[model samples]
Target chain A: MKQTPRIASLPPAFGSWRDIRPLVAVVSARYRTLLQYRAAAFAGFATQLFWGAIRLMILAAFFAAATEPQPMNLTEVVAYVWLGQALLGMLPWNVDADFRQQIRDGTVAYDLLRPLDLYSYWYGRTLGFRVAAPTLRGIPMVLFAMVLLPLAGLGDWALIPPASAVAFAGFVGSLVLAAMLATAVTLLAHISLLWTISGVGVDRILTVLVTIFSGLVVPLPLFPDWLQPFLNWQPFRGLADVPYRIYSGNIPPAEIVPELVFILVWTVALVLLGRLILLRGVRRMVVQGG
Target chain B: MPQIEVRGLAKTFRVAERLPGLAGAFRGLFHRRMRDVHALDGIDFDIERGELVGYIGPNGAGKSTTIKILAGILNPTSGTCRVDGLTPWRDRRRHVSRIGVVFGQRTQLWWDLPVIESFDLLRDIYRVPPATYRDNRDRLIALMDLEPLLDVPVRQLSLGQRMRSDLAAALLHGPSLLFLDEPTIGLDAVSKLAIRDFVRELNRDRQVTVLLTTHDMDDIEALCDRVMVIGNGRILADGSVDGLRRRVRNERVLVVDYDSASEAAMLAAEGEGVRLVERDASRVRIAFDPERLPAATLIGKLLAQGTPHDLFIEHPPIEQTVAELYAEHDMRER
Candidate 1:
């Protein structure tokens, strides 16, 4: 039998390039794992499409019965609803069962023993999950709706490209920022499991809050005037409502920059807050057995 | 300096006391009660380099807590612990990078990925250079006889196979100190022996300091030269296995299979200080304190009664000795 060489006597000082490998490895691993569940992603897209049609019919009926001029035209409303359906996968409504299981089983100790920063490690995974799910489900759902709606003689209501190249670029940028913000928010819920010790309550609360406030249930403009300002000011709206509005050209050219800035601020704040909570939670976990 | 040193280490967990029913649970929401559970208290030990130490105790004896503290996964409530001259919890990343830990009940491998993929991922996670990782991975695979299982997903592995993979995974980084917590639990006899042999060889060849926590007495007797017996959050005994047995009792048991059932009863009443501890027809187990009566004298007395069919004298099994130790110290609660 061959003799095994001893481990390197000296610990290598990690260069910046080496430090990034673990993060990239975490993200790619999670993305690959997500890809393995392609059937589920397709099922999720189909569910969203089904709900989108029901929502569009309701909006159409309301538009026909309206007594006053609506803020959004019929074509814009259809586009908004389709965008909401496509972006449904971007909502951070689902709880991470694996993280909760790790906490409960005390196996989370292994995670702590790793040399990497725990928050960033989990953040990379969450980012991968957020992007992978949307890429697999959302983009396909948007394409399907774009083709189907026009073929079914709803040509005026088919998905519209952003008004200009700058607007299109801004829409993509906002979507990426929205995904980041959503991941950070979802991570906060997962970390809250350290205190709750169970995911059900947190999962339910986040689901309800995200459903009502994220404008996935209904576009923010359709809400009563009194509620629109409050919904727009909240961070949940930035997840789906702001990005979809930007994509559908619902937000005017002048307002796009401020809306994108609002999203940027929220993303930065949530990321920082998530990092803080994760550190405190990890300390608590180390002190009290995981 | 000792490779591992712990002094007056303690840990206390503040656990919420929840009420039983829905109403009580609701009542607890407003004014919840918290109680402190002291998992470890004043734990102290020093293990030199290349020492293979067996850490044994009943359930909830704080063995796992102590290992967790030393592994840099948990913070101690008080006192101090140092491994390889670094405070584990304080210098966590650096400390952990030098130590390998395996919890038999849980795996560190990616569940859905192939064993080789998880190994590759661990290499990246630990930032091992490609050449070093390849050499180390190949050596471990060969040593563990795991070449056949590398392509199999971890979820598809049997417990024994998974354990072999886990042992290899923990050693891939070439840690100087290894903590094996119940490493041989739930393995077939063959698998158990294989792991024991591998661990023994690793300790011998690599000079890796090993602190093994296990319930298996055979494992302790086979691999450990020094044993630490913990009970009720304290070290009850720490010495050689013989010393531990001596602390409990100095009795040797003699089982005689006589020529006839009649001779068994006649021999049972013959020797002084020799009590009939157990008897089944012609076979009889005689217990005698070795200090009171030597084995030779006791055997002479038994042979005078009759020439027995067969007889042998040996110290009681380590399980009974350790159990007696636990009962004597009132640490048998767990």
Candidate 2:
């Protein structure tokens, strides 16, 4: 029989390119696996197309009937609504389903056994999940809304390009920040399962929050005056509202740096809170199943 | 110094007690009750390096809890545990890097990934050296006969095949210490023997220290030189297999097939340390301590009573011995 060779020495704790290798490996593997589900991506694109058309019709009617001036013009709202549809998959609306099942069955012990930080490992997985869906469907949605609708003579309801070249660049920066912020929230939901075990309540609450507050349903600038301040300061805005507005010039290029700062602050805060919560959870985590 | 040392190890969990019925559940939604369950009640033990120790116990007997704590997967309520001079929970990353764990009922492999891909994921996760990983991968695949199953998703493999793959996955990092929680549970005879032989070889040839928790007596008898029996969160006995048997029971049995039932029952062969254990129509089982009355002497006395008979001496099975130990402990508790 061949002998199993022993490890000559242990890997160092937390520095060097080696520490980041696992994160890249896990994220890429998950990205590859999730992208294979092309049918789900197509279904999502079809569903979002249906919803976007309905919302655009309603917004066009609302703008036509209005006597008072709107915060965003009809053209801008058209762009905002189309942008929401294209990027709908980027919202952090639920915990990782496979991880939730692992928690229920006590297989999470295997995760704990690995010589990696739980928070970072989960963050890598969430990052991969957050990006894959959009990579598959978002481009097609953009092409359909921006090019095909205008070609079909519905130019008024088409997704216009970014307000300017600078706006486009700002949108790109904010979009990357948006993915990081979204992963932080999703990673928190994953850690919350260590306490709740079942994520049903969290999922329902998060869906409502992400859909409404992230400007996925209605543009933040059009909200009533009283709710505008609350909606503006909240962290969910970074997920969809920040990037959409940056793309539409609702948040001007000059103001984009401060908005990006806002997102970085929230991401840092949530990640620290997640790490602390995970530490406590692992300490108190009585393995549930046999 | 010992490879593993645990002192005053205890764990308690506060479980929510929900009332039964719809009405009670509604009431429970407003008013909740809590109860504390003592999963591990102050146990202590020490194991030397390169020792293959069997930790056996009944269900919910703190066996899994101990393994979890030692593997750095759980933090005990109050205790001090050191694995290779490092505190498990406090220094979990450093501690876990040196040890491997396998749970029979739960897989460590990724559910959706192919076996080989999962292995590759682990290679990066542990930051294994490329040459070392390649060697171990090929060796384990050959050793476990996993070449055919390497491309299959984990969920598609049979239970036995998955168990073999899980074992290989656990050893990929070449951990010198292993904690196996019922590694052969729900396995066929061939798989069981295969796991046992591999574990024995790992411990003996590589000088790996192993702590195995199992309900299978054959697993204990075949692989371990030392057995630790735990019950009600306490170590009841810890020593050699023969030592445990001596602690619980040391009786030898004599089976006599007589010509008639009446003759078998009426043959009151007077002797000390001898009693009837079981009786059929014409076959009688007599229990006697071989130390007090030799098997040959007991057979002689039984044969004098019935000449037309066949007789044989038998030692009790290990299962019977272990069950009796549990029963004896339960009786004492009552």
Candidate 3:
């Protein structure tokens, strides 16, 4: 019998980006998806602007009520609040929910069969969002804030170019911490579903805690005396408060070391916890007859 | 060399038991019950390179559990599986690159993107080189007839269209081993035949190894050279389709149009192990196992004994054979 030649050869190593080729492909696809709905993107940007204006109005009221003449130095406060809101929009909540949804919907089966590492895939996609979401809303919010303030104060804005650079790194750290914590929490919640049909209770509790403790609405520093100590030590504070404080210069660079260490600790701890839950939970997955 | 090997594969799951009613629900908030479900139990098989095997089983009979384990999704409780000398679960990332899997009910394609976009994303996901990706994608698109669906969003495609796209997607990376689980479910007859024809060509021409699990028996009859029946997480039978047919029953039906209905009834009574299944005014059909009495022998006997107008003999469909096998093993519940 004659020999049959193989048409295609396997990749040298699995899940390794052989070249810049595949990464570019994944980024391009994600970009095209976000651009597909023009109206939705516009509406999202408009919502950010509307909320930024409302926050600036509240700060303006505080300046008006001040007793000292320049007690009303509202420029820095307005810029900070606007930038904080924009940064808040950039952070992602693991949607701890997709974990349960994927398992329930059988989509996890499809994802696992793919060659790429699940962790790497999620990280790439979330990084893509970090880039896309911030640019879409952040740039406009800054532009709007610039129009409302004077070019004189914009002199201090020279600090912004470097400040933004430092802010970007700190922002990324915040997203990673949030994603890892949510993933860990989601894994914990999802494991319970192996025994219970409903994961609603756990899901609601997680969302509520992340929202209040992560400082999405109010700054952690603004919390009452009784709550400040508890919020300071929790992982939620590291996600939003630590990063924002670093960005606004509320905590000087010299003080960032401790916050960075805390965030790193949380990331490592949550990753270990997520992996443990997955290893243990999978053994109990009982896909019933369909 | 055997490309795929399995020995004593077993999997078990601990299921939580919930109480019923308002009182039971409130009482069970603190305490919960647990139960164990055995999915796959001691399954063993070996397939050589490029062998197309059909794995058939009733629902929850471990067909999917075996597939999931082989695909590296779920770790088995005990036992082992190796494909291309790599344990699937232990080294999943490397193992998955060389194999392609398509689940009939799910689409790997992203719903919001066009078919081409999802393919591009998968190229990145598998890290396929651009030159190779272009060539392989073009070949699959042509072979699977997906030229028209490439620009369309996956959500908008018809079930038949999506399945065709999925098949092309699975082959885009040019994997040597392919696992197709219920690939033809809910497809129209024309689409089913097209898919079967394409898979047959892929196996015969490209030598891609295939392990298919399907509820549709026609798929097995049309494509598979060997069939493995699994029940209660165990391999019940493994052999050629013809061998399976013999085990169930080789019953062939003889339909006779007789000059008189009475003569047909009289001839049917005279024959042993031949019973009349249905009859009209001038036509009668009788079922008899071909092994007990050969088709030619039975026909000759019937013709010699009765004055019939026309007669023909045909075997029962494969569905009946599989049903009988399941019934014999008491595996119908699964």
RMSD after CA superposition, every candidate: 6.2, 5.9, 6.9
Question: Whose lDDT is higher: candidate 1's or candidate 3's?
Answer: 1
What lDDT does candidate 3 reach at residue B76? 81
TM-score of each prediction: 0.87, 0.87, 0.81
B276, model 2: CA deviation in Å? Answer: 6.9
Scoring only chain A, what TM-score does candidate 1 earn?
A: 0.89
Each model's total of backbone clashes: 0, 0, 1
Residue runs of model 3 more than 4 Å from their true location after superposition: A1-40, A64-73, A93-100, A129-132, A148-290, B258-269, B302-310
Model 2 stretches astray by more than 4 angstroms:
A1-19, A66-75, A105-110, A150-156, A161-165, A225-228, A286-290, B18-33, B254-288, B293-313, B331-334
**Tens digits of per-residue lDDT for model 2 on A250-288?**
888899999999998898888877776775676556333
DockQ of 1: 0.33
What is residue B40's positional error in candidate 3, in angstroms? 2.1
Model 2 reaches an interface RMSD of 10.0
Instruction: Output DockQ, candidate 3.
Output: 0.32
Clashing pairs in 3: B59-B334
TM-score of the second chain for every model: 0.94, 0.89, 0.93
DockQ of each: 0.33, 0.34, 0.32
Top model number, DockQ: 2
Fnat for model 3 comes to 0.55
Chain A TM-score (model 3): 0.66
Residue A13, model 3: lDDT of 20
